[model samples]
Target chain A: MGTIVSILVLVLFLTAILTGGYNKKFLQRVQGSNMWDWLTTVDHKKIGIMYLGAGGFFFLIGGLEALLIRVQLFYPNNDFIVGDTFNQLLTMHGTTMIFFVAMPLLIGFMNVAVPLQIGARDVAFPFLNALSFWLFLGGGIMLNLGWLFGGAADAGWTSYVPIASNQFSPGPGVDYYVLGLQISGIGTLIGGINFLVTIINMRAPGMTFLRLPLFTWTTFVTSALILFAFPPLTVGLLLIMFDRIFGSHFFDAAMGGNSLIWQHLFWIFGHPEVYIVILPAFGIISEVISTFSKKRLFGYNSMVFATILIGFLGFMVWAHHMFTVGMGPVANAIFAVATMSIAVPTGIKIFNWLFTMWGGRLQFTTAMKFAVGFIPTFVMGGVTGVMLASPPADYQYHDSYFVVAHFHYVLIGGTVFGVLAGVYYWWPRMFGHKLNERLGNVHFWLFFIGFHLTFLIQHWLGLYGMPRRVFTYQAADGLTWINQVSTVGAVMMGVATLVFLYNVVYSRKSATAASAERDPWDGRTLEWAIPCPTPEYNFAQLPKVRGLDAWWMEKMAGNKELEPAEPLQPIHMPSSSYRPILMSLGFFVSGLGFIFRTIEVGVLGLVMVFLLMFTRSFEQDHGYHIEVDQIKEAEKGA
Target chain B: MKANAEQTKNQTAVQTSQESAWKHVTSFAVMIVLTAIAFAAVATNLVPSHLLVPLLLTLAAVQVVVQLYTFMHLNQKGSGFPVAFMASGIFIGVISAVALMILV
Candidate 1:
């Protein structure tokens, strides 16, 4: 399957190259090398697109895993995929969906939208941004490489210590998990720091913190969360790596190392990771809802505070997951309360969205549909979440299909829906074309209905004592009918994904007419001020943001364009470099070597990586500037 | 006019240099005194053994603040963002340590 997928991807790439279209022409401008321009490009927009493409590919792989799991469970006593293979499928599904699909997709949105929303030309460090993407891609490849090499990680995405230790499940599988996540986690950490710096330093004149768009504000908070959260995860991965590769005993119970230390470290990173993905989705939903409702976001300050509060409280409640671990009443009570209090802020956000749409012209755009649909679906998820927060109730629900259902409702109904809404919302800005609304609506409804149909019944299945992480159930277990429903719903969602893919291609072919409109949704944010097919220098002149919804404010004042934050001048743009990809490739090679226990190969890869770093330190490549005349010409062409 | 501007810039540069030199020397003297006091406390048994670790930690913390402000120039103009990030990182670090102490 991996080979077939690789071949398909290669064929697609060759086709794109040989077609001799605009991509070929663009490549020819860069010394006749087809991949050179894009490969070396440090443009945030291109990087963002690459992130989305890679994330979409992983999403499909994760989705396929999901379908297979559904099929395996479609009938009781099913032996389609039993035991360890099932474990691998489930583990890879969760890992890929969280790390590879959801987070990167949100990061892609951030890369495309945040700088634009804040009226900046580029991120604070475009080179680092490119490097972050490459590292993530490399890590993703290393992770899946385990599948081709006889096994994948089978100890679940959480990879609880005792089970993951060499004594029990000794294989290269968990090693792959550790090294892959370690590499990717570094990329995510740097990416977080880059955004924090960019948002702090690079906002245009008059774009104060309060005046910033909701999307940018969420990106800011999310980056801060990522900065704090990913470190513990890296430490956890490193310890496990040491225990496995170096034969240390950080997590090995026999050597007096406490197993729960890994749990603490993992969840310390894990809980905030939930918010790191969700906060950006919240940002996207806020943007889409307000734009479609044609009103300012109601209680904007409260919404911002809610987002921050959620991020902070996310850390306090990590122990809620381990409630049954006998943390005693005090710890359990405190964590439960922290978990429940999160609902207060989440409730504020839900009401804010509702009030924003109240007495306003509601445009039922595809993005708006997803945003609106997200409210009820997420509230249901939240309700279940609050229920599960109670320690006693949690014991009953823990590791059950109910727990699975609750998370899927929240993660799929909240994060996935938000991403789809964002993809529809920002498609025009990112790709210079609107997705076909008719196809988009079909995609939304099918996915929405399919999602509920799939997971909603599983809650009852959990109540009826259906355990999770088990491959099959006996006929006497009475889970057959519900499982069939879930399988059918999963199939519908698969079809919906196909339709969405079709819309992407269909819309691109018909893009010329729609691409002309800069403000496709009569957008409220600063990103809309730039012309479609955003020039390499995003804004010819940085926009002066006067108030919230800066573009809308200017439009209300009858201005055709944003007030320039600065005089028209040559734009200093960063030059592309090959170092980032090469460095990531080095890490990728090192990962493979470590997984295979090839010490010499691993050392060689490390040498290559450090050598690149040494050269990068001394290299002084002052980037070229975009002439003001070129900016003018580009604006004229647009 | 250019020469006048240049003279003023150079003058201010010299003045600030002298002022910063005085600051650096004063901070150096203060940090030395702090170190000496820490050593004296340990050598002379100024505090009970039970409280000594906390006292030393507090002294160390104070020295770190001084070093950051005086030597690292975190007290300089336009350093608010870095200060905020550092302060928050420290705050969260302390919080997490305390939480783990209690919970883990």
Candidate 2:
């Protein structure tokens, strides 16, 4: 009964907030100070901005956690932080950076860019897209919410079992991990399905499969990967949840269960997840490289095939992570070869980028600089990856700083660099004004030097037998100087990030300083055809994709814009509804209930979920139609 | 927007839906028979337990194909991608399960 009352209060409060949280009514605030409009918006651009904001916020938090770890290890035998707090920091840093930072940042670009590039009005399921974002936010909150309750998960982000069992950990920390990932994983899975459908069905009339943008193509493959990859994660989390909340013995070795089961389940999803994040980065690099090179992407057909091949190979190499677990010589050998084979497609991409820029009039803008810089850094990481793939050599590098350096080299070098490129490349499209290019250059160079400085030396430290995930080292270990240098480099990276943030703020103040949003970069895609600060209705008339580089072809032909494929008509769009927020709140509340062991709260959450579904089913939502006159006015203003 | 083309499109859509319904009905009947045979083989104890496991496994695989092609409409146009993903997912799952059982 108490749970019921609190849930009711929460519902009423959320309703009030969604309907009347602003100074004006929700409808009025659509043109007023509309915080509520954002909460309930099904607009892809707004949701994409929200994703960028939330992901950026989480990136900062994760970065802070990294700084704390560095501070603890800056000196030998330093007493900066104790073991427990250090474990929490390490776990949160890994969990937050992978789930909260990289995934959402890429998805944000997908939301904003995919529909525009394909010449679609919105995603196939606009309402579900909104729900995916909200659920992600809810899950991120639940994972961090443990900081206030008792503790955050300290079993590492993988949450390997036996150690992660309820009896051993004995707290709500891992519980939050299990529940938080499950909730957010569902959102990711749905988001992937949405993208798959949108790309397949919503392409412009002439946008053939062979003619799709590389970003759209990567988005398509990544969605397929997410569809297949997230299941193993979902099942793994379910086993863990049962073990923690319901007294299952799935991972309890004493009960005839195997702990290796958890590892197998995790790496199945975990290995592909690396591709899930990196493939989009590959797509971003392809776009930036070709655009700045003032040429078409070299080896386009091979690039597409290589992307699909990589996704398939991603599933084949999960066992490589477990070579140390006595998986026998044959299994280890098979996985080792499989892992090394990934370099084939990756090498193809590298050479393609190089060839794309070989003879073109290259523009060394900040975005292109990052794209060019990513090549060497990412190749170095790939070299280390092959080195680590050998089980014989991995025996030496396992649990060492070498492994850490390899991934950071890949992740920071590949994913982070690609995100920065995309942000600089698309900032004018996302926001009304361009980011100050001078500051972006400073930001890029500082971040680049600092990144190499921090992780590159860690390779030597690992060879020196310095272990990873350790809080501190003994002074006699002779590891002080290298560690200090690494930390110093971290500080430089942090300072570079601050410069970027200052650029954002300083740029915002001078919003009208220039009107460069309209094809500022002389872009090649359909997205560049529109005026920057794109109108809500993205395309007045569907575009006919005559061929690849559709807009570029038109511009070259001296037709200011491609001929409209059809006359204007009233556009039917999905209604902007608040149920997505309410539905995610249901999952969030249930997560809280599970953590607290309150059955009633969990039940109430399910009830809210079902109740919303029931209401949505019976409701008649024909969707508001934007009149042809309003569209004419919008086009006139543009 | 030719009149004859529109009529052909609508006619094919109707025929496709009707064909799907029949396929589903036939597949459902076959699934029931396969399930009953498997259960009867176990219940009647006519076959040895050793042989029964393989028989049931083969029967189950066939039934799955039937369900996928007929009930799930995997044979339909535009289902090529989903089928491919599901097949690859199953292949990966089987490899992981087999390796875990044998090696680990």
Candidate 3:
């Protein structure tokens, strides 16, 4: 099977190169036309859209998984799904939503917004950006590949050890978990490094850290969190891979391997990983709230400090997740206190957002609705979080539906809502089209209601002593009504998601009026100062930043556009390459080989990967320059 | 190049190459001396077994410093992020390893 697959992959790849993907003339023609352009695109905009598309596709899969889980639990002693299938649905739902859906969608927004906000033509390492996407996608595909086999990971998304060990949960299921995440985690780490370099080294002449758009600021901090957080996960996953495939004893207790090592390493990465996913949302909320309110962000410096403080505190509070693991009173107390203190920074952000919208003339756009709606819901989540932080209370909440409620509040209310708000807010900038506001509001209301209905009941159910990750309960437990209600709410959310899908489709069908509005929403950031569907070379002439809200400053100064910081020069843009895709495919193939313990396949795959890297090093393709005349031609209408 | 009648375009190139050669020789001498002392300590059993572990670890740590500074040029100007990232990796590794050790 493996050989056949490899041979087919090689054939298809060679055919693509021979046909058009690599031929210089064919590449140029197809570059302006079809699938080859997307496959080999180094354009941050196209990559961002691809991330969005992939995230949305995964969201549907995860949502279906959620629906299946909820349906099984809708009634007492439900047989909607069996024990094994329930576990698969549960594990895949959590894993897919967190890793595949939220991270990529949020990264998508960053890819589109960060470069424009920083006034750069593209990311500093455009090639690495492409590599990041391919790697992430490759990892995602490998992870989902488990479904095509007999089973998928069933040890929960956390994949707690001893239970998840090969002796307990045999087969390729857990193998998929380790290798899939390891490959993807590498992609995410390099992406983090890429953004860190881009933000620090490629900002426009005057776009200092303080002057940067809030979303860009959050991307920077999130990338830093990724840098520090992902390594432990990589180490942990490699250990598990060794334990599973190579007959090593990394997490095996009979061999004197301590399981706490996995927990500590996982949560150390896990805690920061949540912040990694959420901080970008925080940045998005700041942008949306301030934009709709027609005000500069309240307490820009305070907001920046708050964001950094949250990132810093994110590292110290991983032990909170391990309170039930008998970490001792001193450790628990230290972690509990550290966890609660995080609220101070978070609260500062909350109030600053509120103050930004307090007295201004606010627009009640759909994005604004989500932003306004996020405040109270997130605070509710935060309130519950503080409750959970107390170790004593957490003992009761651990593995309970209440814990589920608390996190859904943070993840969904914070990240998902922020993603929707960003999508709605930037859709015009992203695709040069507007999603119908009335339809958007309908989608928002249903989702918001569904979110509250589902999670709100869960808090009570958890308090009533119901455990989580269980498929069903007895009717006599008196939990039937709430469970049913929770299921109903989840269905509503699914319906709400359908409404959003409709809005996107409808908006695209009638895109005649949506052409490139340079300053839609009267945006206050530098991104808005540029043309919509942003030019390939983002800023023809970089804008000089004079203040925090530079674009707003220019608008107030009665200038129709930003004053040019430099005379237009030929933009030195990086050429697209198929190497990243080839390299990632190598990782995917090798990962599959390891899972099945096929040494020859693994060797060949790795050799192919390294050879591609060697070829890339030797090939000196100095990317073509966009001429000043071409820039003038493109900017003619503007 | 060493011919008496030959002229070099840049005079400083000769001096700079000679200076680098001396530094390399000095570094090599220091490394050899350190290794010899470490070998003598372990082979002669002058250090107790438990104490030997610490002694070797100390020597190995010193050797790593020499390797990085002399061979890797970590002291150079462009090595900031690499140094920071490496230090962070070490810090996290130590924390994890210690936490697990204490827990068990």
Candidate 4:
């Protein structure tokens, strides 16, 4: 199977190269674009849009993988997908969703919204930001390339050591997973640092910490979480890479090494990683609910505190995931308590949302509906989360359908729903058009119903002693009906996503004139203060923030708009360049090289990557800037 | 306000040279103490191989704090956010590591 996949992947690559060479127009587009333009482009909005488009593409691919799994499980003892194929599908689905889907979508939101909320023109390190996005895209491509090859990664997304070890699973698939994620993880880390610096240093004058919008605040904390959470992952991946490529004994239990070390390293980055994925969604829900309800976010201080507390506790309870590993009752009990403690802060956030909606004028926009829907869905996910926190209870649930149901609810019901809400909420700012509300509602209902139908029953199945990750099951297990229902739900989700795609395309032609207008929601944040389809550099002159809800404060003071922080000054904007893309390409080539190092072509590929790196580093150029007068004139025209 | 400004300037100058010298001295002292303790543990066999790793890790933790305060100037003003972020990362790293050690 693996050999066949590899052959197919090679064929696809050859086909792409041939097609590129054959088409003059395509080659021109690829080669004619100035290399420097793409390498250094620092426009936050553009970077954000790129992230969204890339992330959306990956989401579709991951969702398709999910559909495949559902189809396989549709009937008892089904052979729609063989065992190895089933394993690969599950692995790719989990990996794609977490790494390719959730992470990029959150980063996309950050790239688009962070600078705007803070009244900054761009992130502090725009060049690095562009580089991060490219690296991420490269990683995503590498992970998915397994499809063309004989198979995708068959190790579960977590890729536990003994199973992922070279001796047990001798394949290039896991190598692709490790290298792809390592490259992308570097991008995520850089992005985290960029946002941390931007938020801390570049806030508009008088936009004090407390005065910042909730979304910006969450972005700030989330960046902090990323800074802290990603390094361990980097360390773990490096060890794995060394073990796989250089024959290191770090995770080889037979050697003087411990496999547990990898788990520690991975989960250290993993637990807070949940917050890294969810906090931004929490921020989005905060903004959406408040805007639609026409109220100040309830218990603003508590919400802020809860976010911080969750982030803090996120690091503490990672061990709960390890309870069944037999750390003994004392360790288990300690981890269990630590895990349960997270629920307090998470519960606080839920109530805060409900209170924000209480007694306020509620407009049921598509964005708001998702936000409202998130409460119950996430609560169910959360309840299962608490249940799983108990060590003894977890022994029964470990690696069962229950565990699968728990995370899907949290990730899909929590993070995916939040991302969808953000897209609806910011669609106008991003594309100068609203997603068709009618279609959006259809998308939401189908998705919500389908989501519950699929995973909600899995919990019962788990409780009834069904193991997860099984490619097939017998009719006698009584799992057949529930599996059929789950497949139906998966189909519904597929239809909903199709409707969403159509809505996006359809709205391009016939969106209301009102939809084209920026600040359609009479929004409180600084982002809505700018014109729709925000300018490339973002702000002409940074807005002076006076108090909480900076825009709202100005409105209340009868100023009608923000006062400028300074007279217009020329903004030193980074020019777009292709260095980042090229650098990532080098890694992609090197990955292929590592996977097939026995071949002479692989050696040549590795050498080429080294040469590319040296060439790229030596050829750096000072970025270009736009004059203040040009920005002023542009703003005036708007 | 003027007097405060003058005093602040004097303090800054004194602190700059003093802190620089102190930083060098403290780092040297820390290195010696850390080496001595490590050697002593090895000599006495007080640090078992299993505990040796954890002990070295603890030492590294101490060194990190020292580095942050002295080398990174995290204890000083204008260092708040970066320090906070670093601390948070370390906290998360430690928790995840400990969890993985027990769980896996």
Candidates sorted by DockQ, best first: 2, 4, 1, 3
* Model 2 lDDT, residue A265, Cα: 89
- For residue A234, model 1's alpha carbon misses the true position, in angstroms, by 0.8
lDDT tens digits by residue: candidate 1, A115-141: 999989899999999999999998988
Q: Of the pair 1 and 3, which is ahead by lDDT?
A: 1
Q: TM-score-based ranking, best first? A: 2, 1, 3, 4
Q: Write the per-residue lDDT of candidate 3 for residues A1-638, one digit (tens) a residue.
A: 64566566666766876887457887677767778788889999999999999999999999999989889898899898978778888888898888889999999999999998887888888888999999889888877888886478888999889778888788677777787888888989999999999998888888888999899999999998999999889988988888887888877778988788889889999999999989999999999999999999999999999998899789888989999998899999988999999999999999999999989999999999999999999999999999999999999999899999999999999999999999999999988878899999999999999999999999999999899999889888999999989999999999999999999999898787545587879988888888766789999998888888888999999998888889989988899988999989888878877877786666767887899989999999999999999999888856
Tens-digit lDDT string for candidate 3 (B6-98):
555356668876887888788888888889889999889988888987888788778878877777778778888678767766676677677
Q: For model 2 chain A, where is the 10-residue window of minimal lDDT?
A: A1-10
Span of ten consecutive residues with least summed lDDT in model 1 chain A:
A1-10
Better structure of 1 and 2 per DockQ: 2
Output DockQ, candidate 2.
0.67
The regions of model 4 sitting more than 4 angstroms off are A1-40, A511-515, A598-622, B1-67, B93-104
How displaced is residue B84 in candidate 1, in Å? 2.1
lDDT of 2 by residue, A382-446 (tens): 99999989999998998899999999999999999999999999899988778888999999999
Candidate 2, which CAPRI tier? medium
Error (Å) of candidate 1 at residue A598 is 1.9
Task: State the displacement of the C-alpha of residue A362, model 1, in Å, after optimal TM-score superposition.
Answer: 0.6
| TM-scores of all predicted structures | 0.94, 0.95, 0.93, 0.89
Residue runs of model 2 more than 4 Å from their true location after superposition: A1-33, B1-25, B44-51
The regions of model 3 sitting more than 4 angstroms off are A1-7, A14-32, B1-87
| Minimal lDDT window, size 10, model 3 chain A | A1-10
lDDT to native, each model? 0.89, 0.89, 0.88, 0.84
Of the pair 1 and 4, which is ahead by TM-score? 1
Q: Please report the TM-score between candidate 2 and the true structure.
A: 0.95
